[model samples]
Target chain A: MHRTIVDADKQKLNLNLRELFNYRDLFLILAYRDLKVRYAQTFLGFFWAFLQPAATLLIFTVVFGRAIQVDTDGVPYPLFAITGMTAWTYFAFVLNQSGNSVIGAQEMVKKIYFPRLVIPLSKAVVGFVDFAIAFLILGVMMLFYCFSPSGNILYLPLFILLTIISALAVGIWLSALTIRYRDFQHVVPFLVQFGLYATPTAYPAETIINSLPDWAVAIYYLNPMAGVVEGFRWSVLGGAPPSDFAYISFVLIGILFMSGLYYFRKVERVMADIV
Target chain B: MSDIAVRVENLGKCYQIGHAKSGDFRESFDSWINKLRGINNGQTGESKEFWALKDIDFEIKKGEAVGIIGSNGAGKSTLLKILSRITEPTKGRFEINGRVSSLLEVGTGFHPELSGRENIYLNGTILGMKRREIKAKFDEIVAFSGVEKFIDIPVKHYSSGMKVRLAFAVAAHLEPEILIIDEVLAVGDAEFQKKSLGKMEEVTGKGRTVLFVSHNMGAVRDLCSKGVFLSKGTISQQGEMSKVLSDYVNSEAKINKEGGVVVNVSPLDKEGKWLKGTFLKVEVEWARNLFQEGINFDFSMRTVDRVKLFAFSSEKRPDFKDLHKRSKITLLIENIGYVNNELFIDVGFKYVNKDSYEALILNEQLITPSKEKIESFLRRDILVVPGFQYIIE
Candidate 1:
């Protein structure tokens, strides 16, 4: 027999990893469900995943590479833009999906008991699957350009991991906040929209680095995705590593991750009631 | 201690009623930061405290099936939520000495795009069944739901009844040590409901504890050996199943406002105390055959001098559906603002598919409670208005 106690006054803020591990199958099942449902009724099915980044790549290449002629050093503008978009798209998707995850599972939250973190965590995983497909397209593009493999390519995994962490960090806070203040839902799409340009997605980061003063550059990298964008380009296109300013991105991401987790845990207890 | 499967001590759940009239972003954001900083000073907003479950205490020994009986808003569902760990209590605590699984609704976590087979696994996991256990019971669950032919098809195509059957099959197959169910068996047809009840009985026969909440007294009498009756968020009676049930039925009789042939009355709040500003829901039953196209029932309150005060109609309300044969419906009066006067209920029915309902004999007479009786129920010299500063003595 297992003993369970429920006390309303006692809040369980501890991250109970053992309980999470016990429900790991549920996490996998939810992630699988999200993946299957995304393309279930679509006409193009899984191609839609590749089509999103492809469409973005086309528009960016035309606007920035052709019309404006944004410098990508010597690397092809399409290759550089796609590499950055692939990572940025993953972060945006995770933020959008995970942010609405609690509201999406409103019925389940009120009915049963499971680790609530699983809802947002599963969105991150689903977003990663789409990211993986987009990355494969980049690999094909890399080969198409006859781009030689660089040793910096090994750092690619580290940057991907950073992108994943950054996405989950923002995702957790938005998802938790959306439950109490429905105003946050309206805020998400705008964040993702404005965030695309805010991160150095379509244009080169070097343009901002060389043009801005040292302190101003440091302030720009405070956006967690700033480090992610610069690191990803360096890993894929084999440029010099991101400047000292990139280290600010790491500090910003760490603070964001910790605060997001704290805010999520605080609001989690009242979720079933408000949701 | 070892013999007890569940023990709840002074358990309570409080909800802050009424949305704030005017809230600013700065106020909420401040509280949010304070919450994150782990500094809870308990000063947040201006909402009244409504104790949904207050000082609710009970115990169910292992292998015993306990029935929870209550009227609408009697905290039955809130108690189940706390027991299921879906929500936290605002006060007190409870302990359970077994693997507990609750069925508050059918197909809670099911996705419509998933096939019936996949939903079984998905829902089973939500109810806390391991993958291997679901796999072992896969064939039995499919056969029980009677949806073998459409097992691989998306559940969107399945009829609602078929969905209920499939969901109940998975939940019934779950082999938890303690099973908590809330009004889910009310779905599906009579035969399926009977089968589900039998499945519940079988679970208890295997020495598992069961906590059942239902309005159907017949089913509760058949399955549960002990009973708890909740009224206004507190227990009013508990003992042998028959005794507790009798107490509940007898208490309803004490609050019956009238002896009318047209309608039966069941009070909503305890002893018919309708707090100001809160909606009062009265359960009414009448013969369904009297229902016709454009047939309408209206509840009116009038002064003793025959002057009408207010009239509410059932024309737009959804609960007025299925008023054929014998039917029970709830009439919700949104706010109880009347003060310093005793108002009586006058129910009138009209059967009109035409322009005028004036000539129709709505009802032979009005259904009004005794004035003295209402005064005794209120037990106060002055009626205090909600959201106003006053004391009832």
Candidate 2:
């Protein structure tokens, strides 16, 4: 046998991106399967993506806009709610689906050897398709409301990319944790539900940051979704750009993403056995 | 030098077998104490770690197909899992020179909602096959699996046999450098088993290394050139397939040789009775002797409560019996007509100090009447009777 000593200081894992690239067709097929099975028997099919955000916007606009009397900064409450809800819904969908992806594909994990990251990554990609459809609806709503955005809308892709990265970062950590402790599965949805209000999904970020102490605003901005929501709103609506606190949140998101990927790789080796 | 393709050194794996149900309070208390001590509290009292394979070291050269044969709980599966990287070793390491593909179980990578065509790509990808390679071999896989008509249907709708066929086809066709299969061939029907074995033969013929685990000795002999016999998580023997198999079987037979009497007899008749029309009692007697000396002996038998059933002495022998010593003898009555009820049959050998007896050697219990038919009890064909062997050394 060809023996090579494994150096402790050197990186043990050589993630072959080429190998993953070679399996791109398989990844696409899996992502397509997830999308197909999801809307297979449903009458609305892809429209359900837009419908979920639209329906949630209607409910939140009535509750927070009319009942709670939250300010929308001269934008129609429905339009504002739909835009933020679209991003939040994609985040929630990716979190929930990718959190359970490994467990859902336990058969594949236990039987074969593949990059375990493929399972969660495929779910994230499928969620992106949903996000795109919902974002289309938001674009139509923007047109109907006669709210023309400035040239800053070109940065919208960057914000969308940020939302996906954050979602995948948390998703990788959750997927790895859920394989061992099934309690994380129950904890994830509850966290997502509570996170809707915690982040500025329905209300403007300035409403919370302006009213709270500087320390509290800094602490609140540490949540990556806060930065993502604000960044998305600024890019799409050409409204107020994120302040220094949001930059710290961007740094925090990068750290979580890297650490989550590292932690996921470490746990990926033992998942077949422990799972 | 041997063309070694796989080398395993000091490889060991430990598994924690946890009780399915325990008191929640007891479990929590154990975890709390473990956490305070700063030990790994997550792996606590719910488990007791066991080394399935310990310090195992071996090597296999290129193009050598090895068979791992073992009894249940003999760590064969654990060894395969370690080699396949299905689980990491607790304390040890190994090096495999080539790409390893494992078929631990059939249909392992098949997604139920995906179509057969879709699953071929999915399973192939998981087996480490490239898209172009899968596309090139797609038709061959479908043809081998024999599910061309239903390739587009969801796999959940496929029969289990169909799924197994497709799974095996995908795995066997993938053409990995090293293949590890663990008892997957046991699931399919006989025809399919033959087909799978043929495919395995073809795989090995291509000069790829193969590690196969199975309990079927016949299949091991047929398929593998080298064999490793595992017993209680250790390699008991390793060599040519026939030699290792013989050693394994002989060791097992010798281990099971204690506390039993063997008798050679004709077939038993119907109604689960032996010698239905005969009236006779048969007794076998023997004594362990190291010295070849002349010593007269007598054989006797009795019921459980010391009621003598039959007795015989050296004088009963017709001729040439006086010249021998330390001899074993058997008393055979011509016909045992019927066993009236349940009885414990004992046999004893008389010596100078005391007579040692084989207690409760045989329980002649009559089940139902033998009057119905004689064909059943007439089929009692005893192949070998070690009880009749008189040991002189």
Candidate 3:
């Protein structure tokens, strides 16, 4: 028998990780629903995932690799950009979807009781499906170029873990803030667009790294996706291993993610009342 | 103490009504800037706090079905919500023993793109049922909904009724130790209402505690043995179902005067002391000069199910006279036969001379006390025994 006590106090950062784990089935179903629902009404279907980065690779290969070469060492530009694109796509999808998840589930949020964390976490899971498709494209492209992935490929899963945590860190923070301030909702879409250029998806991080003064490069790593993109490429394309700047990205992601969980739990108490 | 399924102790929920109206950035940012400048933004002055449920204290024993009756804005839903953990209370606390399931609104989490079969699993899991539990009850739910044919079709394609049936079927099969429901019986047709009511009774009969909130007085009386009546965020009465229900119905009958019409109904014993289940004194007042040819007051008694048991027009009295000035008409009926069905008296008026007049009718619901006193034999089909006498003033 479960005895539940509800009070006005203790409305702080109570994560209820056990409760969240108990609702793991809800999380998976929601992720499954998010994935199925996208294909439910669309004609192009999951191909959209593969086509988005594929098209971007084609555009960048022509624009950057040919028209305005930005020195990718020697690796084919398509192979170089695909890794960064896959990482950024995962980061952007999680940020955009999880940021809007609570508002999108407003009806359920107001009426049902579950660990609300599942909503954003499920968005992160759905983003993985897209990431896998984009990563598959990267694998096929590597085969076409006859380039074996760097032995650093052992660190690919670590980078993927960093990608998810970095995405969820921003995703969780933005979603909690978006509940209180709707203007954040408008900004989320713009983040995905602006983030495409701000990260190293279209060009190597070196292009900007080589130009910036020493201190500015340190600040550049603060944008978590930069490290995510560089880290992904180093593990897959075996370019210069990401600079020590990537460590700053790792540390900042740790701070942002811890604070994000704290802030999400704080807002969750008032969520039913406000949303 | 262990038998108490729910106990609310001084529980209250407060909502902030403010100029900002919504949780948007501009106002919060402005307020933040104003605070940085050490100036008050006047937001604090403009915002007011309203307690939806205040100092609400009650207890429901296990196996007791309790009905919470209230008028609109009466905080019934707030109580249920707090108990269900849908919203946190502003002050104090509440305790619920055993597992509790709340049906604040059915079909709350249904996704349009998901097939009915998928939604059944999705919504069930959302409402806190384990997947294996849902899988176990899957066939029973689909059968109960009678939508087995459309189970594989997306919910968006199902008609609204089919969707509700599916949602309600899922809700009905959830066998929690405590069930909290709010106004779900108001949906569906008469037959369906009967079925829903039966399902609720079955829940109570299984020795689970049920806290039910609804405006349907008859259904509440039929299902709950205990009752709580809420008015204006406070509990006005709570006790045996018979006492609480009668008090609720009687208090709802008030002298309403808007749109140039007022109606008041109160009962009296032959000795003239205020009483109930006896003769009724009905007063109908209308604005002067509107009824040029005098007004005809219509008095009616109908079953809560809306079967018009009797309707009598004032113009039928031989001694009645026409008046064009301020008019107050009173009708004293001798007896409203002792029938146990909950009844409603509707008071309406229009000009007696105009065959068809521009609508000037106000239907005030005058209520009859619960038929707790009715003998089984007296409770039959519609019984409209007219008053033994009528006196008009």
Report lDDT (CA) for all predictions. Answer: 0.79, 0.70, 0.81
Q: Model 3 misses residue A69 by how many Å?
A: 1.9
Q: In model 2, what is chain B's TM-score?
A: 0.61
Docking class of 3: medium
Q: Write one digit per residue (lDDT tens) for candidate 3, span B130-181.
A: 9999999999999988899999989999988889889998999898998988
Query: Highest DockQ among the candidates is held by which one?
Result: 3
Clashes (N, CA, C under 3 Å) per candidate: 2, 23, 0
lDDT of 1 at B183: 93
Give the runs in model 3 whose Cα sits over 4 Å from its true position.
A10-12, B19-22, B34-45, B255-261, B270-278, B286-300, B311-338, B347-366, B369-393
List, residue by residue over B1-393, the lDDT tens digit for candidate 1.
489999999999988865332224566777779989998976777557899999988999999999999777999999999999998899999999999899999888988899999999899998899999999999999999999999999999999999999999999899989999999878888788878888878887787899999866666877899999999999999879978876776565323223232333333455554444444544455444545555655566554333455556666655544333444545555334444233455665555355544222222222223223222223234433322121111
Higher-ranked by TM-score: 2 or 3: 3
Candidate 1: docking tier: acceptable
TM-score of each: 0.79, 0.75, 0.90
Q: Write the per-residue lDDT of candidate 3 for residues A182-233, one digit (tens) a residue.
A: 8888999998898887888888888788899979988878899888889889
Question: For model 2, what is the alpha-carbon lDDT of residue A188?
Answer: 95
Query: Tens digit of lDDT per residue, candidate 1, span A1-275?
Result: 58998776776777776887899888888888888888998999988988888998999999999999998888898898888988899999999898789999989999998889888988898887879888998898899999986899999999999999999999998998888777788999999998897789888787888999988888888778988988988998887788778889988888888888878877778889887
TM-score of 3: 0.90
Q: Which prediction has more favorable DockQ, 2 or 3? A: 3
True contacts kept of 3: 0.75
For model 2, the stretches where C-alpha displacement exceeds 4 angstroms are A1-26, B18-47, B254-393
